[model samples]
Structure formats: C-alpha cells, structure tokens
Target: MRKQILFLLALSLLCISFTFAQNNVQQRKIDSEFLNAVHYYENKDYDKALTGFDNVINNYPLNSKTTASYFFRIKILIGQKEFERAKDLTNYFIETYPSSRYIDEIRMLKVKLYVDDSEYFDALKEIAFLIDRTKSISYRIEAKTIGGQIAKSYLSSSDLLRLSNAFTGETVKPYLLLLLGKAFLKEGKKGDALNSFTRIIGSYPHSAEYFEAKSLIESPVSGEETSSGQALVGVLLPLKLNSAGEPTSNTAGEILDGIKYAVAKFNSGRTDKIGIVIRDTQNNEERIKQIRNEIGYNPNIKAIIGPIFSNEVRIAINDFDATGIPIISPTATDNDLTSESENFFQANPPLVIRGKIMAQYIFFVANKRLMAVLNSVDGYSPLLAATFVDEFSRLGGTIVTRQTYKSNSLSFAEQFANIAIADSVDGIYVPLAEKSDAPAILSQMVQDSMYVPLFGNQDWFFAKGFETSPELSNMLTFSSDFFIEFNSKDFQEFNNEFSNITGKDVNRNILYGYDTAKYLLTVMKNVDKNRTAIKTKMISGLTTRGYHNNISFDKHRMNRFLNIVRFKDGVFELIERFRSGSL
Candidate 1:
C-alpha cells in the first residue's frame, strides 16, 4: 500500500510541472511576438506589424503583452488615416487601463487625431480633459498650445471674453489671455487688442506665442499713430494721369473730380478731422519727380492719391523709401508694384491677383485645358496676360498661341485667324483697357469661325465697340469692378444720386470717381487737415468699404478687389468677384 501511494504522489507532481512549463512557453511566445511587432512598427512596415499584434492579441488575450498591443494598434490605425477608429481604441485603452503609464500618451494621441480630422471642437474637449487629468508638464504644455489654437478658431471677441472669465489657473490662464487679444483685434477693438498684445509681450516673452504677440505690437496699426493720437489714412491711385495718345487730355480730370469730392466731404461736416493732398505725374518720369518733391517738401500732406498710370508708379518708388507716408492708387494693375514698394498702397484690383481668379474659373470651374491670350501693348494688359500664362501653365494648361495686338491698331484678323486654326485651344484671355479693341478682335475671331470661350478685362463693360459689333454675341466671359443694370435697385439708387450730384449718366469712370471720393472722405474724417498727418493716415493701412465695394491697399498701395463679369445677350452678367488680398 505504501509503495502505490508514493507512485501516485510522483505522478501528480510530474503533471503539475508539465502544466507550469506549458504556461511559460505560451508567455514567452506572446512576449516574442509583441517585441517583433514593435520592431516592424519601428521599421514603418505597419501592415506586417499589425498582423503580428493581431496574432498576439487574438491568441494570448490574457497575456501581459495585451496592453502594449492595444497601444500599438492605435498607432497603426492613425498611420492609416483611420482617425475615428484610433480615437475609439484610445478611449478603450484609457478605460481598460486607467493606471497604465501610456494613458497620458493615449490622451495626447486622441487630441492629435481630432486635430488631423479638423474636428477642432472635439479636439478642444479632449485637450480640456487632458489638461485636467495629465500630470506631465510637457503633456500639459501641449494641451495648452492646442487649446489656444482651438479657442482662437471658434471664439469671437465676446466668446473669448466669456471663456477667459470661466477658465483660470497658471497653466490655462496665459493661453486664454492670448486668445482674448486675438479676439479683440478681430472685433476691431484696437485699444483692447493692443493692450492684450502688449501684455503677452511683457509677460510671456519665452512662450511660443511670443512672436505673434510681438508682431501685433509692431504692426503699422500699433505704431506711432496709435500713441500720438493721429489717424493715418491712405489714398492709393495711379497718378501718372496721362495715357498713350491722350497726352494733356488724360484721366487726371476724372481722378481730380474724385479727390475733390472726397475733400469736400471731409471739409464739410463730420466728427473725424483730416487733411488731403494731391500728387501729380505726367507719366512715369513726372510721377517719380512729384513723389520725391512731396516727400522732401510737403511734410503736411499726410496722404497722397494719384499716379493713375502703371509706368509712372515705378518713378514714385522713392516716396516709399521709409517716408512713412502711404500712397494709395485708385487704379494700377501691375502685380510687382505691391511687392516692390513697402509703403505703397492701392485702391484698385491688381491684374496679377485678378489673373488667379480668372485661372481658377477657367481651369477648375470651366474644366478646360488649352487657352490663348489676346494681349495688348497697354501697361496693364501685358502684365495681366503674363500672369494668366504663368498661372495657367503651372496648373497644367497648354497655351496654343499667345497673340499680341497693338493698342492703337485696327487690324487683328491675323491674330484671330491663328486662334481659329488651332482647334485644340479651349479658351481665350483678352485683357484690354481701351473700349474699341475688344469688339474688333472678337469680330475677327467670329468671322474665322472660332467658337472657343472668350475672357476679357473690366474695360469690356464700357467698350462701345461691343455695343456696335455683331461679335458681341461671341463674348463668353469677362471681369469688371462695378456694373449698372437697368432693373437693379443698387444701380438705380447709384444712378439717381450720381445724376443729381454730377448731372451726368453714371458711367464706369464716374463710379470709380464716386468710390475714390468716398474712400478719401472716410479716411479724412479720422485725420487732420495737415498734409503730413493726412499722408501718414492714408498709408497706415486704413481700409475703406465703399458703395462700389470694399477697398484696401496692398503693400504697394494697389486695390485688391475686381468683379469678374460676363457678357450675354447684349447685357453684362456678374460671374465672380476677385479680391487681391484673399487670393
């Protein structure tokens, strides 16, 4: 009996040893698979890594490697752009392993995933949770940074103010303060915004938001004008005044009428006091001379408007050499003007900027590839045409032919004939300033049996040639600044007011006159009559929203918005509006 009992005991012990060995082997396999999966993930072979991780989780559900496998799986999902699934997995990991060391990492990953998907509001919520829960300083810093961005994105001035009042603490307060400043600036509260920017500069000098804060403090709006109690206004217009063949009979008279109208409004009755002055140039040569004289002699003229021609603007560059006086142009389309002159400002749409809008409409909206440019010798036309060519080329458009026409020439049949023969070309870009050029070109194109899409400049609206030419029916597209329809209420109101005031039909030129005047008058209200103050205010980035549209000068003092119009059935239809700043 004793021998049999001992044998049973030894057999039981062997069975227990076998069971322990099996568990040890299974655990070793799970650890090996988990390590290999991590190696694959590190090598960026996510598909293979995911396969290994899936095998470990599926076969060893209760193994010690499960937590790590879950974490890595979330990362792989994120790499695949499966943000929604990654978010769910992150949540699951946090809930299942609340005390896991990777919990902070999971929270951060969730926030990032939300940001990647542009779910800013949800990101904000996750950041708030992380800020409250995480103990890591680096993690908290990240959360604050993201929170600042989210607040800036969704919160307006009032909303920011409310948020600031609600959130308080060392970690959260600074970001909220920065957001508050941005909010105030967006609401046009200059004083409050300046104060907020100043606070950030003084206190958070080492913070990442410091640079932006410094920029706001150093902005033109926050400079000497704000402190000196002087309003800096800008009047931008092409002052060259003279055009080809017109000589003494130039656009200067129309520009002057606009200036006088603005001056009259300023000198009349208004709360804002302002000063106005004129800078005249015969063309490019006279423009440079006048600008130098104004900067050297006239310290009183705070703002200058004129130099209506593009070539003349190159001459006036000396005025922008840190004179601090802003030059606003009513009409100048050269794209390089803004980039060249820091103090230069414009009130009209630039051709380069407008060309982008035209390209977008033609290529993306119209879905056409082949194009032709019917270019003119006028200063603005060539620049605009070149811009269209460069932009369209970058967008994969094939230019079949670039046809050139002299501004004063009457013959264009050969140009149109070339385009008509190229049956592959899909569209035509015709930029002309003179009214007579378009109809003749279009007529020739029609006579040649060219039925391709046509695009034109703002001048098409006033072109009498179009009114008289049967080829007007061939105009498929064009761009303009303002239009007066027979039945529109805005047009009727503008016509009545303009006729009563100027005793003339409101033509395109007259609309320019009114808008220019309104812009100057609005700026003048905040300025002193002294020329220096006027010039200072005029160039100080003051924007004017007028009857025609909103007017703001770029760095070179050029207008930023132009309406793209189309001609159909003998009447003009509004197609799109291009703003220089937005593009």
Candidate 2:
C-alpha cells in the first residue's frame, strides 16, 4: 500500500509539471509575437505589424499582453486610414481593460485621427472629455492646442460658445476664450468679443492668453491693420448673420475663403501684404448704409471689392462716390451702376452690354449684316433686345424687324410673321429669361421657317436639345459673362492651390471672389497704396487673366469682355472672345 501511494503521488507531480511547462511555452510565444509586432511598428512595417498584433489579440484576449496588442493594432489601423475599425477596437479595449495603462494615450491619439478624417465635431467632443477628465499634463496640453485651432479657425460662433462652455478649469478656459474673442472681433461684434477678452484680463492674469487679451482690450476696431507694409481694402458682403452670429450663406463664406486665399498668395514672395476690412452688408439697404457710415474716411481702406447685387451697388455709391474710393462688384449686372458712380467698377458686364456683345459677335465674328429681334416684355429680354437693336444698327447692320410678345406666352405668330417677311435677315435674337421658354420659341421659329442663325443671351446655356440637334448646334451663337476651360492646366493648378489654401473645393461663388480679388490685388500690388491711385489703375484697362475669364474695367468703368460660345460636333466650344484688347 505504501509503494502504491508513492508511485501515484509521483505520477500526479509529473502531470502537474507538464501542464505548467506547456502553459509557459504558450506564454513565451505570445510574448515573442507581441515583441515582434512592436519591432515591426518601430520599423514602420505597419502591415506585418498589424497581423502580428492581431494574432496576439485574438489568441490571448484575457492575457496581460493583449492590452498592449490592442494598442498597437489600433495604431496600425489609424495608419492605414481604417478609421472605423480603429475606433471600434479602441472602444472595445477601453471597455475591456478600463484601467489599462494605454487608455489615455490611445484616446488622445483618436482626437487627431478624427480631425484628419474631417470629423471635426466628433474630434471636438473627444477633446472636451480630455480637457475635463485627463490627469496627464501632456494629454491636456495637446487637447488645448488642437481645441484652440478648431475654435479659432473651424468652428462657428455658436460652436465656439459651446466649446468654450465645455472647458472648466480657469487655465484651460482662457485659451479658448481668447480664440473666441478674436473670432467675434473679426465678425465686428466688439461687445460680445470684449466680454471674453475682459474675463481673461480680470480673472486670469497669469494665464497664457492674458497679455494678448490686454492688447486686444486696448486695440482699435478689427481690420484697421494698415500698419506700415500692408494695404487695406474694404469688403461689403451679403453675409447675413443669424442670431447666433453664424453666417447664413455658404456662398458668402466660400467667397470670403477665396478672397483670403488671394490675399495670402499675394503676400507670398513679397514683403508687402494686403489687408481686408470686411463688413456685412446683409444684402440690406440699412446694412449697406451702416457699413458706409462706419467706413468714414478711414484712410486705411484703399478700395472695395463687393456688394453683390446691382441695387446694392446703387446704395453703396451713395457713400463711396464721396470718398473717391473705387467699388468693384463681381456679380451685379445692372446696366447703369457704373454711370451712377465713377468710383464704382463693375467686374461683371452690365445687362446692356451682354446684348451689345452678342450683336458685335453676330456682325463681326459670324460676318452677318442684317438681324431681327423677338423678345419678351418682362425681365432682361427687353433691355437685351433694345441694346442689340441699337448696337447692331450702330455697327451698320440693318435690323430686319424688332417685335415683342408677352413674357412666357407661346404665341409668336405676329413677331415671326414680321421677321419672316423681312428681306435678307442674317439672324434672329431671341432673349428669354426663362430657359423653359426656349423649346417653345425654337419649335415656333423652326415651324415658321425663320431659322437663319440664332443669337441668344447667357440664359440659354441651361436650355437642353440645342447641343443635341446638330442643325441648331451649328446655327446658334451666344455671349456670356464668363467661361471656364475646365481641363486647362492653369485652372487645374488654381483649383489645387485653392483647395490647399482654403480646405474646401472651388465652386463658382469662390471663383468669382477669387478672380475679383486676384484682379484687384494684381492692380494694387504695383500702384501707390492709395484710393486715387488704385481707382486710376483699375479703370485704365488693366487686364489680367482669371480662373474663368479675364477682368478689365474700361473707360466706361464696366467689364466689357464677353465669351462667345458655339456648339459644334455635339459639344460646346469657346470660339471667340470680344474685348477691346488682345487676349
């Protein structure tokens, strides 16, 4: 019995030793795999590193090595731009190992990844938690620095307020408040901005933003930055602000980005910089008058760039005309705006000239001598009709006949009858504001057999079927304020540069603002930095190439260049340009 007991105990001891030995080998393998993953990560071989980390994490979920494995795997995911998987794994690790040493580090890393993914709002929320909860000093500093950037450059005013309120400590709050104050100051909210600056000054004297706050408290109103080497230009935009002080129009914001990019690009490779003092015209008469009143003889503002509407230009000239400061509107089309104020320059051609441009094209480019006009009584059609009649006649071309019908009515027998009976009609000008009205007019013109050559306004670009029918495609010619050769190298370069500068894609709203700014800045760069000098250089036919077209304000103080597009072989082609100068 004694011998049997001893043998049994020895056998049990051997089994226990064997089980412990097997477990030790499995642990060593996991440790080796994890070290290799770290080795791969250190050498920047992320794909292999990802697989190694995955092996440890999947095989040893409850093991101590799995915590570090999760961390490395998430880092690899972020490197590969696998944001969703990284985010999910991050959450799982944090929840699984709530007290893990890498928790704070991984969460901090997530904020930057979110920003890179353009998920700013989510990044901001993560930052708020770090600012409030993290005990690590480095993590808190990183959060504050990134949060300040988002608050100052990316977030709207209301968003800034929400972010400001998210931070609690006096030390952290002042940094965000200063950024918010500076942003509000730019938007012309002196009182609202002062609240933040004053708080920083009064309560947080040793804070990082304290001195800047003190300087801001004593500084003059924003946009008075005409210090020694910088030139100032005033911008009046239809950027209506909501109750929360956020701009309601994305168009206005994009335009502002383009304008700022132009300023930055101009300042590059030169010592002199151009500064802009912007005001919100709100697209309202009262707002325009208020901005003008605020801009009284502040010798800093050298020239003005915009008041996007034609009637607004009429209102703006009431003040700018007296100051002798030039105002250029990028999109206004009223024919008489330039005449209202010699100081007012129209970057877009007036409606009267859209007609005159087409007339010149029909006579000179198409080599036609006689023309007939059929137009609607309402909208710009009549104005275009009258100008085409007068200019074609002035160019020694005969008007076969001119007729008008009620706008949007399909019946055109009276007008077509007069045009059909006319002798040697070289072309017909049908100016319709409604692109939908085009098909009916074309059908009637074809039915009445009055198709000689068709001339049209810019509105016809949206009308369909003109490019589809080879007969009409070859027959039609029209004039527009601008055209973009999209595949051109210069345009593509401009687009890439604009995206790099503004963090947004280029759109037409941005293009107009960009072209106008480029034109104005190119004009201002060489001349004396004074309103009189700027005005003289602008109106003296200083033509510069633009992203879409060229800009030049001639003797009439209006941009007279029009692009003539013709459809041929089932594609619209920019065939000619009508301007006083060579391209």
- Among these predicted structures, which one has the highest lDDT? 2
- TM-scores of the candidates in the order shown: 0.46, 0.59
**Tens-place lDDT digits, model 1, residues 107-170:** 8888888788877666766676677567786687667756766766675677666655665554
Residue 418, candidate 2: C-alpha displacement in angstroms: 3.0
RMSD of 2: 20.8
1-583: candidate 2 lDDT, tens digit per residue: 9999999999999999999998899899999998998999999999989899889988764687888888888888888889899888877876777677787787777777788888777777677766666677667766766776666567766776787887778666777787778778777888989999899888888775676677567653473443343578888888887899777888877777778788888888887778898888888875675476456345567889898877787888864575678898888988778778888888888887878778777877788898888888888889999888888888889988888888667677777888878868878888887787777777777677665788888787787756334676578778877787777787788888777766777887887888899999999877788777788898788888876567887678878688888766766677766773321
Give the least accurate 10-residue stretch of model 1, judged by summed lDDT. 220-229
Q: Candidate 2, TM-score vs. the true structure?
A: 0.59
Candidate 1: stretches off by over 4 Å: 1-253, 263-269, 278-301, 310-315, 332-336, 350-354, 364-367, 373-383, 396-425, 432-449, 458-475, 481-487, 498-510, 520-550, 553-557, 580-583
Candidate 1 yields a Cα-based lDDT of 0.66
